[model samples]
Target chain A: MTLFIQQLFDGLALGGVYCLAAIGLTLIFGVLRIPNLAHGTLYMLGAYVTYFFLVTVGVPYVAAIGLAAVVLAVIGVLLERIVFHPLRNAPHTHHMIAAVGAMFFFQAVAQAIWGADFRRMESPISGSVTILGAQISWQRIVIVVTAVIVLGLLTWFIKRSIHGQTIEAIEQDRTGSSLVGISPSRVSMLTFGLAAALATVAAGLVAPINLLAPTMGDALSLKVFAIIILGGLGSLPGAIVGGFTLALAEVMTSTYVSAAAGEGIAFVVIVLVLAIRPTGLFARAVQR
Target chain B: MLTVRGLSAGYDAVDVLHAVDITARAGELTVVLGANGSGKTTMFRTISGIVRPSAGSIDFDGRQLPDLSADSIVKAGLAHCPEGRHLFAKMPVEKNLMLGGYVRRRNRGRVRELLEHVYELFPILHDKRHQPAGTLSGGQQQMAAIGRSLMSDPSLLILDEPSMGLAPLVTAQVLDAVAQINRDGIGVLLAEQNAQTALRIGHHGFVLAEGRVVLSGTASELLDHPDVREAYLGV
Candidate 1:
């Protein structure tokens, strides 16, 4: 029972992390309709930014996270301006090629700047507390709490704010959005920057536990893609539900079976579930 | 308030609009009548700056419009209510209407006034304000679409095929709303396939065929013309 409770916390914390990271990708996909392969790189960049701020600049963890988010947002704006803007009208194939190229470019740049090292950052709050015979880390709890708050705020923003309303409107009908005076280009720029900033905040929270490496984002992005697909592409609630579901499934596979099974099980479940419910778990139904 | 002189534009190599010339004056409802594929929509697109003119010019209130972006042209007091009644189907009727006021986002007071104005224009929309746009009837959806365009408080509105797919009665209600909007002092450049009804409400009309203006005359002249009667009105 204790082992089960411990693993549940672990799964929940991991799910929270996944939810944060997957949201950036999902929002970019949902609003912009771009398969943002570079999201993974932004995640890696965010982790690195956090590392640089925490270790090199020697700021407090909270301040470091804040600084890293801002830096990543600026980087995101630059990324949109320099790369995505020019290729905005390219064919889908070109978009795919460009994103793959961007991933490698960021990886190479990181390698040159930081070197090929698998580095780890120490959590500000360490050690574990026992409750109901299960040991839980303070950091993990923070992850879960922060995820809920962030997602809740995001939901609120989209529901109540004018800018979020514009995004929602555009997602519904692009031509209609234009008539309402919403500039798709400007919205895209802001969304990319915001998604990048969100990625950095998620990275800042999770990097201490997962550690950091240039190659980290590749597998993480694949996992997030599975999450987005499982949740229903472009659906916010779907992403959250999918993230938790994927994390629990992986954690259960690791606990009951083998670690190897955990890694490959997401793909297996995706293939099976997608085969049955083609449009995803929460696909937007066509209205009359 | 709007002028197009020898405007030629198209998608890539194929020209969809050929040297189109038209003018829409303030306080008048100008109708551009055409069958499907007659470049009426392409003309609207050019006027709203969705597409650039390959030749000639689009002047709105003495400012060049062709080179400006769609949003800029919208900011310059032109609004387009596109065909097919493209409402945000899943969103509330009020949100769909509020999104129309996106350009004037900074002005909450004006937006509130506009909201009240639109609600008054289409009282049904206010009654169904909280419902998702998809749940509205065909007539109500058309009213919401028109109400949305009015939220921007545009000087000249380019309405594209406002009567598409609606029943004759619903079309009449929608056209009546357009005339009411014009009476409120906005210039209306309406495109329609329903020639007789459109001419009845319009001050003047232009006919487009195969991307060229085939006929141009006052409302009564267009209704009485032999070619327009044979080709469009079926009289």
Candidate 2:
């Protein structure tokens, strides 16, 4: 029973990371209607930015994470203004191609600057807590707490705030939003910035445990995509459910089944959920 | 007041509206009547700044609006209630209404006042204020759309097909609300395929056929015209 509880706690910690990544993907998809293929690249960029601030600039680890998030948000706004804005009304294929191009461009830039080295980020928090007779790292607790706080704040904003309501309006119908005086372009920029900032937070929290490299986010990106698909394309609650579900399933599979199979569990879950629901587990039946 | 002269618009190569001229006066309901594919909605789209006019000019409240964005046009006091009652489905009815005042950030109190006024106009919206807009009936959604437009406190309110896909009783209810809206001192530009009902409440009416205004006159005059009766009024 203790073993099961330990694994569950571990799963929750990992799920926090997936939730952060999935939130970025889902937010961009919800407001922009474009599946941002470059999202993983932004995640990788966040980790590198944190690394530069902490190791090179000699900033405190926590402050580095905060700065990285702000930097990534600025970068996201720039990308929105320069690349995404002009292509707003363009075909889906065009935007998809641009996202792919951005992904490659950012990855290449990271490789050129960081030299493709697998670097570990030092944990800002040290020590462990005994939870249900299991020793859990403080860093892991921080990750889970951060995810809960960010996701909670996001939920409140979308549910209650005026700008958040405008975002929802734009998501439902862009032209309708415009008719009501919500500028789609400005909302798109804000959504993109928020997505990038979330990605940065995800990276900052998990980089200490996972090695940082240009390709570090590749698997994480695939896992986030799977989570979003399982959750529902644009449903925020679905992303939360899907993220934790995938994390728990992976942990359980690694503990009981083969460790090798644990890596493949997310994809399997995504396929199974899609086969059963098609529109995703939480997706509404109404076609947009 | 709104004025459009020699307006031409199209998607890529095919022109939808060609050199269209229109004028809407203050405190009057002006209905643009046409069948489907006659560029009725397209006209609203152009006026609302959704579609860029290839040539000519749009003058709203003595300001040229050819270069303004849709949001800017709404901020300039012209609000459009688009066809199909495009309320934000997943959002609550009240939130959808709140979005109507997104451009007028300085007048939040006025926005709330407008919300109360719209709720007074359509009591059903107030009852379902917290409900998701998608779950509402078609008539309710139409009311929410109009209510949202009213939230902006627009000087000129434009609506497209306010009677589409509605029962006669529901249509009458929607038209009555629209009539009340016009009576409140706001200019109204309405487009509809339901020519008879639209003209009944409209102060001035224009009959559109094949992307051009075939006739324009007082609502009573157009209602009595033999050609309009035969072609549109189903007399």
Candidate 3:
């Protein structure tokens, strides 16, 4: 029983990172209407940024995460303005192609700067707390707590803030929003910046627990795609719930079934969900 | 006041509006009557800065509107209640209305007043404020769309087919609300396929056919014009 509880606890901590990453990707997809293939690249860069701040500049762990978020936000805005904005009117395929191009370009950049070698950052958080005979690492606990706070703030902002409401408006109707004085371009920029910040923060939180490499984000990007698809594309709550669900599934499969099956679970989920309910688990016909 | 001179605009290569000339005086309801694909929507979109004119200029309350962005145009006091009542269907009706007041959001008290004004104008919307806009009856949705545009406190409100999908009684109710709105001293530019009903309440009217203005006059004169009656009124 304790062993099962330990596995469940581990899944919850890992799920926080997935949830944050999925929310960012979902937000960009919902508002900007871009699939954003390069989303995972932003996560990879975020881990490196966190590493630079923590090891080179010697900033505190939390401060490193904050600085990484700011840096990623700027990069995100630049990416939107320079790459996506020009092709806003092009066909959907054009956007996807551009995103894939961006992903490759960023991966090359990361390889050039950080090299292809894998590096692991030391966690400032050490020690473990025991609960019900299960040991939980302090780093994982910090990650879980940070995810909760950030998710809470994000939900509140989207639900309550005027700016967030504008984002929602744009997501619902682009031309309608513009007629009412919401600049779609401005909102797109803000969404990209926010998405980037979310991705980076998620990456930074997990950096202490995982090895970092230029290729690290490739698998992560695919997993996020699966998550968003499972949750329902452009559905915010879908993405949130989908993220945790995917993480827990993987954790359970790895523990009870085979490790290889756990690694392949995302692809299976994508196929099964698409074949059965392509609109996803949350999407429904518009009310009325 | 709004003025459009030699305005030409369209999608891609196909021009939907051709050198359309129009002038809507401040505080008066100006109606543009047209059949489907007659370019009423394109004209309004050009004025609202959604579709850029291929030629000519637009002047709104003395501001050069051609070069301004869509949001800037709204800030300049022209709110477009687009055809089809494109409210954020999933959001509550009040949220949809509040978004119209987004530019004036900094002035909390003023926004509140605008909200109150819209509620007063469409009490049904106030009662259904918490409901998702898509769930409203067709007439109520139209009311919500008009109320949303009014929230911007636009000096001139451009309404495109508020009666598009409503029942005859509901259409009359919505149009009555529009007339009441115009009496409140805001300028109105309305486009409608229901020509006679629109001209009855309008100060000035223009008839559009195949992307060109075929006729223009005071509402009473247009009502009596043989060409208008023969073509649009089906008399």
Per-residue CA lDDT of candidate 2, range A1-288, in tens? 778988888899899888888987888888888888889999999999999999899899878988999999999988788878899889989998998889889999999999887888778789998888888888988989989999998888877888877777777887888888888888888888888988999899899988999998788889999999998898788889999999999999999898979999998998898789878888842255
Stretches of candidate 2 off by over 4 Å are A285-288
lDDT of 3 by residue, A85-147 (tens): 999989989999999999999999999998999998998999999989989899989988999
CA-lDDT, candidates in order = 0.88, 0.88, 0.91
- Candidate 3 residues B1-235, lDDT tens each? 9988898999996899999999999999999998899999999988998888899889888888988999988888899999987899999999999998988999999999999999999999989999999999999999999999999989999999999988999989999999999999999999987789999999999888999999999999999999999888899
Q: In candidate 1, which residue pairs get closer than 3 Å at backbone N, Cα or C atoms, i.e. clash? A: none
Candidate 1 residues lying further than 4 Å off, grouped into runs, are A285-288
The true-versus-predicted C-alpha distance at residue A142 of model 3, in Å, is 1.2
* Candidate 2: residue B193 lDDT (0-100): 73
lDDT of 2 at B216: 92
Candidate 3 reaches a DockQ of 0.87
Residue B81, candidate 3: Cα error in Å is 0.5
DockQ of 2: 0.83
**Candidate 2, lDDT over the whole model:** 0.88
Tens digits of per-residue lDDT, candidate 2, B1-235, equal 8998988887886888888888999889999988788888888888888888888899998888978888889989999999887788878898888888888768888887898999999999999999999999989999999999999989999999988898989999999999999999989999977788888989998887778888899999999999989988789
